[model samples]
Target chain A: DTAVSQTPKYLVTQMGNDKSIKCEQNLGHDTMYWYKQDSKKFLKIMFSYNNKELIINETVPNRFSPKSPDKAHLNLHINSLELGDSAVYFCASRKRFQETQYFGPGTRLLVL
Target chain B: DQQVKQNSPSLSVQEGRISILNCDYTNSMFDYFLWYKKYPAEGPTFLISISSIKDKNEDGRFTVFLNKSAKHLSLHIVPSQPGDSAVYFCAASAIGANSKLTFGKGITLSVRP
Candidate 1:
């Protein structure tokens, strides 16, 4: 079984459009994270949630928001996407005290 | 500021040979380091890791070495197979950082038979 999964594997939208990516984990993990891999192939963490509570909010723009409906799901919502928003968004999850994180197949976003 | 850095962008190795990937970090507070491998169109998968207290870790043909003083680390794959070709990422996390990892630019490894 896929421990972590993401929906909308590919998203292509125009500038000023909004988009959302969904993530789900079945590893019974309590912590979920959202990361972005830019054109330079640098993967950076944007937000982290533990038990549906926001724990880490990096220096990301307010246009990007992450919502966790429950411990098993975390979704990212982007408002007024720009060309810079075109990159691969990855969702990861891990146990509260564990160090290893399981990642899902990334969702590639292209904002023209 | 790139906390973690993989200076090399790519590495090519012949099958049945040892492939070494190097990484360095600038943050002294980092205590945990990990290596992840990713294929095209997929997310990275955990490979090996080492803690600051230890100098080396080994699992099968994959081993990771850590040097706390130099803030350097390396991953060695012995007898690299063609299937081992992928992009390798080096990541580090500091204590009390809520498991937030700082990743390097990643090195693409190509194993040719």
Candidate 2:
């Protein structure tokens, strides 16, 4: 079993369309995070949820929203996606008080 | 602004030799540092880590050295193997930041066999 997994490994959609990326972790971690990697390979944190509560929110656009129905699953929904939003989205999780984060394979989203 | 920086985008080393990857951070608040290895089409896997309180931590063939005074850290792989070829990312976090990692662009390590 995968420690972390994301749905729609590759997403191709037209600009202005809405899309959602689903994430799940089997590591039984309390902290879950979403990170975006741009074309330059720069990884930036977008949101973090701890125990089903929003803990960290970067200066990401409001069009991007994260929902954590439970500690194991954290989903990201993007509204009015733009071409600039095309990048790989990663889901990560770690145990409480643990410094290491385990990441998912990643979802490659392309906005045409 | 990038808090953590891996100046070298790519590095080449011969197998069975020593491989050293360096990282620097501008933020003094970072108390924990980590290195993750990523292969094509895969997520990053935690390789090694070190806390600011300590200078060195080792795991098998991997070792991490943290120089807090210099705000620098380095990952050393002894007897590097071809399997060690991958992109290594440098990450840091503050103690009270809930371990929210700040990642560098990453460095591609090539261990030529």
Candidate 3:
């Protein structure tokens, strides 16, 4: 069984268009995270949620918002997407107080 | 500024050989370090990790070494097979930092038969 999964593996949209990526985990983990890998291949964390509570919010812009409906799901929504938003987004999850994280197949996003 | 750094962008190794991937961190508060492996179009998977209190950790053919004073760490894969080729990432986190992980630019390893 897949422990972590993401939907819409590929997304191509124009500038100013809004988009959302969904993530779900079945590892019984309480923490979920969103990460972005830019063209430079630098992977950076965007947001983290623990038991549906916001825990870590990086220096990301307000245009990006993460919502967790439950402990098993976390979704990312982008408002007025820009060209800089073109990158691969990954979803990860882990147990509380655990350092190791399990990631899902990334969603490749292209904002023209 | 990047807290974790993987200076090498790629590495090549022959089958049954030893592969070494190195990583460095600037933050002194980082007490936990981990290595993750990723393939194209796939998310990273956990490989190995080491804590500040220990110098090394091993699992099967993969081993991770940590040097607290230098803030440096390395992953060693012995008898590396062709299937072991992938991009390797090094990550670090502080105990009280809300489990935030600082990742380095990954190094792509090519294991040849």
- Residues B7-110, candidate 2: write the lDDT tens digits: 99999999999999999999998999999999988889999999999999999999999988899999999989999999999999986646699999999999
TM-score of chain B of each: 0.97, 0.97, 0.97
For every candidate, what is the interface RMSD in angstroms?
1.5, 1.3, 1.3
| DockQ of each two-chain model | 0.74, 0.79, 0.79
lDDT by residue (A1-112, candidate 3, tens digit) is 9999999899999999999999999999999999999999999999999999999999899999999999999999999999999999999999888789899999999998
In terms of lDDT, the poorest run of 10 residues in model 3 chain B is B93-102
Score each candidate by Cα lDDT: 0.95, 0.95, 0.95
User: Per-residue alpha-carbon lDDT of model 1 for A5-112, expressed as tens digits?
Assistant: 999999999999989999999999999999999998999999999999999999899999999999999999999999999999999998877777889999999999
Relative to the unseen true structure, what is the C-alpha lDDT of residue A69 in candidate 3, on a scale of 0 to 100?
97
Binned by DockQ into CAPRI classes (incorrect, acceptable, medium, high), candidate 3 is medium
The native-contact fractions of the candidates, in order shown, are 0.72, 0.83, 0.83
Global fold similarity of model 2 (TM-score): 0.98
Off by over 4 Å in 2: none
User: How do the residues B1-113 of candidate 3 rate in per-residue lDDT, one tens digit apiece?
Assistant: 99999999999999999999999999999999999999999999999988899999999999999999999999999989999999999999996537888999999999999
The estimated TM-scores of all candidates read: 0.98, 0.98, 0.98
